[model samples]
Target: MAEALPRRPPPPTIYRSAAGEAAIRALYDKALAALPYEHAERLVETSFGTAHVLVCGPADAPPGEPDQDAELDPAKHEYGKWALEVLRGLGLVPPANADGGKGTAPPPLHMGTSFGAAVVLDLANVAPEAIRGAALVAPGGLSAVNPWAFALRLMLPAVLYRLLPCSLTAWLSLVSVCDEPAAEELEVVLMGWKHIVRYPPLPGGPSGVFLPDQLSRLTAPTIIICGEHDIWPCKATAAAAAALPDCKTIIIPGAKHFPAKQHLIQAADWILDWFAVKGLVPAATK
Candidate 1:
C-alpha cells in the first residue's frame, strides 16, 4: 500500500499566553457589543476554500457585498463575489422587488479598507451593478506608489529570516507605511501583521492586479480614503482617482495606511457623509 500523505500543519495562534488570549477575546467581545445591529458568523464555502465572514446590520436590512481587508489572498476578489451570493442566501439582502414588488432596485453598498479597498475597486470593474456604492480606506489599487515605500531596507533581512520571521518583516513594513501618529497603535498593527504573514493565504509578491486604465470601466460611485504619507507610487494614486468618472478621493493629513482603524470615528464619519451625499444612507443616519 502507498504511504499516507503528511497532514498539513495547523495555523499559529496570535496570542502566546492565556492572559493575552483573554485580553484579545475581551476586546472582540467589546467590539461586537458596540455594533449597532446583531451579527452572525459563518463559514462561506468558495471555490478556493471556506471564507469566514461576519454578517452584521439589521436582519431586514438590504444585503450587500463583502468588504475585503488587506489579507494577501490571491483569490480575494473571487471571494468577494462569492460572499455576495452567500449574503443573499442568508436573506440578509432584501428582495429585489422590495418596492411593493414592483421592480428591481440597486444592490446594497460595499466598502473596504487597505487591500480590501483594492478588492472593492476590482469588484466594481467586474460587476458595475453588483453594488450601489463603493467606499475605500487607504486602498492600494493606485499604481503610482513611491518606490521607496516598499521597505527595501528590510528586504535582505526578510530573506535571511525567510524560514520564520513574519513579525519582523511586518514591523519593518509598518515602519515604512506609518507616520508619527500611527506609533500609538504600532504594537497592535505588528501583531496583525504577524497573524497575516504566519500562514498567508497567498504568497508574498506583486500581483499587478490593479490597473489604472480599467478604472474607467467602473460605473458605481466610488470613494477612496488614503493617507498623505502612505502615498505609494508618489502622485500616481491621485492621478488615477482623478481619472475615474464618479470617483471622490480624500487624503488624510499626516496619516498612513491604517488610518481608518486608528481613526475609527473619523473614518466612520467620512463613510456616513459619503453615503448621505450619494443618497445611499437614510436621513436619520445623517
Candidate 2:
C-alpha cells in the first residue's frame, strides 16, 4: 500500500509571490487565477516565518515538491540537510539494505530553479540515496562568482538593500545575471523579494565559491537545463556535466536566468518530460 501524504490544511489562504505581504495577497490572487482550482496550499512553519508551499498531484502518487530558496529558510538553510528533509517530508525512506543488497524503497525525486537548483546539486552530491532523481534549471554554484562581485556582496551592508529603491536594485541584479532584457512583471517580482520583503540574515551569507568536487559525488541520475543566454559561463555548466557520473545537460535557446518565472509553462514542461523519461513519476501515473 502507498503511504498517505500529509493531510491538506483547511483553506485558510493561498499565498504565492515574491511580493511584500501587502502586495503579495493581491499578486497571489492573480497567480491563483491562472492555476487549476484543485491546487491547494499549506503554510510550513519555520524559525523565520511561515513558508507557503503549494501542492498539486494525485492522492496516491508520492508527494513531489519544488523547493523555495534554501538560503532564506531555517529548515533548509544548509544545502546538504535540506535535500534529506525534502525526501523525508515526501515520505521517502532510505532502504535498510542500501549498503549492498537490493534497497527497501525508491528515493524521492526533486526539481529546482536557480539558487534552488544549486541546492539540488549540493544535495545530490551529499545524499544521492535520499533522492530518486533531480532536475536543475539555470543552476549556480557550478562556477565561482566573479571576485569583484563576490567582494561587493560581502562588503555591502544589508541596510543598503533596505535603503535602495526596489526598482534600481532589481534592475542591477537582472543586468548582472541575466542576458535578456527584464520583463516588467519579472522585475516587479524580483523587486518584491529583494527589497519589499526581507528574511532574517544568514551567517556570513554565501561565499560564492564553486567547489567542483561536490559534483563528483552524485550517484543518482540528473538532468541540468541551462539558459543559453544566462550570464554564468556555459563552459562551467559543461564542466559540471562532465563531472557527474549519470547526467545530461540541455541548453535552451533564447532563455535566460529566471526561466522558471519568465517561461513558467515551458520550463515546467521540460522538467515533467525529464521525469517521464527517467521513470521518476510514480508507477500509478504511468
Candidate 3:
C-alpha cells in the first residue's frame, strides 16, 4: 500500500460558533452602554492593514492619547510601529525626529495591558523620544519562561474546558481573578472556552526577556502595575521597573494574573494620579 501523509492540524480561529460571537458582541455592547464617557469608532488605513480604533472621552479632548488593547499581535513589533504611523498620519501624534535627531515637541502618553504592554515597551525602546510616558499593566516581555511548562499548564485548562461543564471551568479559571466575576464576565469566559480552538503562545520560548541594555535605553517616565498574585510577571515587572531610568511600580493586593474590575479601576486611578502629579493631566476635583 502507498504511504499515507500525516494529517495536518486545522488553523486557529477566534470563535467556533455564531452563538458564541453574538454573546460576545452583546457583552461588548453592554459594556459600551455603561461607559461614563462617549466613544467613536474609526477605521484608519495603514500600510499593513486597516486599523480599527476607538476614540473615547469628550469631543474637545486632546487627540493622540492612544489606549492599546490586549488583542494586538505580540509576536512582532511591526503592529505597534504601524499603529504609531497611523496616528501620525491622522495628525494625532507627532512625527518622529528627523535623521535620528531629538525633537522638542511633546510626545503622547501610552497605556497598555498584557501583550499590548509588550508592544508599548518595544516602541519605547525603538523610539524613546516619541513617547512622553507609559502605564503598563501586567506587561509581558519582562522575563523568560519555560515554554514546555507553560504549554502544559495551558493544556490542562484547555482539556478541562473540553471535558467539564463550562461553568465549572470558568469557576476554576476565576482563581486568576481577585473578585467574583460578573455575570457578563463569566459568560464571556464560558463562551471563549467553548469556542476557541487554540490559544496563541507568547513570542519566545525562554528568550522573550528584553536585554538590560535595551531597557536602559527607555528614557521616558513609566509606571508598571501588576497583581500581587500574578506569578507570571510580578517579580519580573518589579525588576524591570527598577532597571528603568524613571519608573514607578504598584502591586494590587489579593489580585492574580487577571485582576478584578475594581482593581483595574484602581490601577487606572493611580495612573491618572501619577500623571497629574507629573502635570501630564489635570487633577480630579474632589
Candidate 4:
C-alpha cells in the first residue's frame, strides 16, 4: 500500500512577475491536486503584486512525516532521516522558537514567493547533503528579477511620511518587510541562534559564517528550469544544471523565469519525472 502524504491547511494564492503568473499558478494547483488537493484557493490579497504563488505548500521537511507516509518510509529514501535531523538541527520543530532566541536562524520564510527562493537557497547552502532531488522553478537569487526595487519604489511615499523615515534603515527591516508576521515571529527566534563558531576564511577572523561561493560544494541531483522569456536566473541556473554531479537542465520554450507559473502542467510533470528518474520517488508513485 502506498503511504499518504500528511495534509496541511488550504494553500494560499501565489504570484510572480518573474514568470508567467497564470502559467505558474496552474502548475502549483496541479501539483497540489496530485498530492491530494488539500483545499487550496486563489486569493485577492497578496504579498507581491500579480505574481503567481503557492500558499501553504508542503512545508520544509516536517518531522515524523516519514513514519506518517509509508511511501516516505526508510528503505525508500535513505536521506529521509538525515533530512529530518537537519530540520531538527535547524530548529524547525513545532512551537518554533521556544526559547525566544531571535536571529539564531533565518527568518521563517514561507514558500510562495521570491523571498522563499532566497531563504531556501541560503538554507540549502547550509546543509546541502541533506537534500536529494530538488525542483527549483524560479528563485530570487541576485539573478532573479525582483520587484524589491520597484516595490520599494511604490512604498517610498508611505515610508517617507514625517513619522517613520528611520524605519527603512533599521536593523533587519528588510527581513520584517519581506517576511510574513509568522516569519517575523520566527526571525525573532533566529536572533538567538547565532552562527556555529568557526575560523574565519578571511582576516576578519573567526566569524561563524560561510560565504555563497561554497554553494558549489552541493552535488545533489538538481533540476533548474526556466522559461524562455523570464528574466534572471534562467540561463545561469540552466547552465548550472550540469555543474552538480547528478544534474539535468531544461529551458521551456516561450516560457520565462517562472517555469511553474509560465507552464504549470509541464513544470509539475517535469518535477515528478525528475524525482522518478533519480529513484528518490518510485516510478509507480507518479
Candidate 5:
C-alpha cells in the first residue's frame, strides 16, 4: 500500500491569549457599530479555508464588489478566485462566462490597497471577463522595490513590539498624525503585535511584481490612487496607469504610504463618481 500523505499544518492565530482575541473582537464590534449602514458578518467555506466577510449596503444593490486589504503574497490570487466563487454561490454575482458567454448580469467590481491591490491586479489578469472595474490604492509590485529597505521598514513595528510590546509603542510606530480612526487602527495593531505567534516574511524577489505585458492584460476600467509622499509605489503606479488600456491615476496631496481617514473618504468619493460614470451605480444627488 502507498504511504498516506502528510497533513498540512494549520495557519497561525493572531492572538496570544483569549483576552487578546476578545479585545480585538471588541474593537471590531465598536467599529462596525459606528458605521452608518447596517452590516452582517458571514463565514463562507472556500476550497482553501473559511473566509470571514463583512457584508454591507442594501440587499438589492445592483452588483457585488469585493474589497481586499493589506495582503502581500502573490499566492493571494487563489484566495481572490475563491472569494469570487463564494459571491457567485450566494447569487450576489453571476458565474464566470454565464449565459453562453453573453450574460446580462453586471460584472463585479474589485478594490484593494497596497499588497492587496497587487492581488486584485493578478486576478484581473487571470479573469478579466468577470470584473468590470477596480480601485487600487498605493498598489505595490508595479515596479522593482528594494527588498531589504521594504522588509526593514515593514518589520520595524514588529521589532518595536518585541522590545516594548505596549499600546503606546504600537501607536508610535503607526501614527504620523493622530486621529480617532488612527487610534482605533492602533488598537488592532497593538493586539496583533502582542498576540501573533509568527509573522509571515514580507514578499520579495519579484513575488508580486507585474511586467508591462501583464499590466496591459488588465482590460477592466481601473483607478489607481497613489499618495504624493508614498515612497514605495508612486512611480510604479504611474507606469501601470500608463500601460493599462483603461486606467486613471490619482495622486493625493499631503498623503503618505498609508492614507489618513479623510484621504480614504476622498478616494471613496472618486470611486463612487467613477462607478456612476461607468453606469455601475447611481450618481450622487447634489
Candidate 6:
C-alpha cells in the first residue's frame, strides 16, 4: 500500500439508469459533497452500544468456492487464481464458497492465513447483549465483483502500487483485499485463451455463489451500506440485512463498489452515530 500509484486512465463516466443504481450514485455524490475538507479520514471507526468490533468477512458466511473471489476482475486471472489457491490452503473461505470446487478434492482445513486483526468473526453472528450495536460495510467474505473492477484491484502489487492504471488510480488507492478468481480451473482459462482469444472470466466457473441464508442468522443492531455504481449484489446485500433483528440499509450515491472513499466521512458519521444512539460511547464522543 506504500508505492507510487498508476494514474487512472480517465474513461468517460458511463451512466446507467437502474433505480437502485441511480440511488447509489446520487447518494454517493450527496454524501461526499457533505464531507468537510478538514476532518476527512481514510479510516472509518465507530463503537456501538455493544462492544463494537468491526469484523470483516465475505458477503456470505461460507468459504467461497475453492476459487471464488467475491471480488473478481478480467485482467486479474493470474493474481486472483493465485490468491484463491493460497487462501484456500489456509481455510479462510470467503463465506460464499461452502464446498470447494466441483471436484472431490478434500476440503481444506481451517484457513490459517493470519493477519493480526482484533475483530473475532465468530462473534459477528452472535453479539453479546452488552454489545448492543453493530455496523457492517462490505466485510471480508467473498462476492463476485465485476471482472473489470477486479482487474483494477490487481493492477498493482502490495508494496508497489504505481503500477495501477491512472483512471483506476483512485480505486487502487481505495481499501480492498484482493482474492483470486474462484471456481475456474486451468482448463477453463486455456480453453478461453485458445478459442475466445481474450476470454477472461465473464462470470466464473463453479465457485460458491453468495447465499442470503449466511446473513439471515444475524441478530444485532446493524447498518449496511451499498455503493451506487456497485453493480453486483448491491441491492441483494441490503435485502439480506432485512431479516436482521435491527438493521438499516444505506446507499452511497455516485460511488461504485468501493464507496468507502467517496463517502468515508458520511459513513464514519453514520457508524459513530449508530453507536452513539445506543450509548456505547460517551455523548461527547461525536
Q: Write the per-residue lDDT of candidate 1 for residues 1-286, one digit (tens) a residue.
A: 5233233233355455666666656655666686776677665443333455676677666533343222334444543454444444444444334442445445767787765666656656545556678787776666645555553633543453455555555456556555543443455554443333343332112553455556676667777777777745424677777767787878777776655455656777777787888888864443
lDDT (Cα atoms) of all candidates against the true structure: 0.57, 0.57, 0.65, 0.40, 0.65, 0.38
**Full-model lDDT, candidate 6:** 0.38
Arrange candidates by TM-score, descending: 5, 3, 1, 2, 4, 6
TM-score of 3: 0.76
Candidate achieving higher lDDT, 3 or 4: 3
TM-score of 6: 0.37
How far residue 150's Cα lies from its native spot in candidate 3, in Å, is: 5.8
Task: Judging by lDDT, tell me the better candidate of 1 and 3.
Answer: 3
Give the Cα error of residue 236 in candidate 4, in Å.
2.7
Q: How would you encode candidate 2's per-residue C-alpha lDDT over 115-154 as one tens digit per residue?
A: 6666666666557677678777777767654446434432
* lDDT tens digits, residue span 57-118, model 3: 76765453343322334445554565576566555566554353475346678887876676
Q: Give candidates' CA RMSD values in order.
A: 7.9, 7.6, 8.4, 16.7, 5.4, 18.6
Task: Write candidate 6's Cα lDDT for 1-286 as tens digits.
Answer: 4233223233222333345345544554564575554222122111111111122244333232122222333232322333333333333333224544565333221221111000111223222221235555553222455556456543343224344423233333243332222222222322222233221233222332223453443455566655655634556555655656666778776655445443766877877677566555445343
lDDT of 5 by residue, 87-108 (tens): 6655656655566345566667
Q: List the residue pairs that clash in candidate 2.
A: none
Residue pairs with colliding backbones in model 3 are none
lDDT of 3: 0.65
Model 1 RMSD in Å is 7.9
Quickly count the clashes in candidate 6.
Answer: 43
Candidate 1 lDDT at 234 equals 24
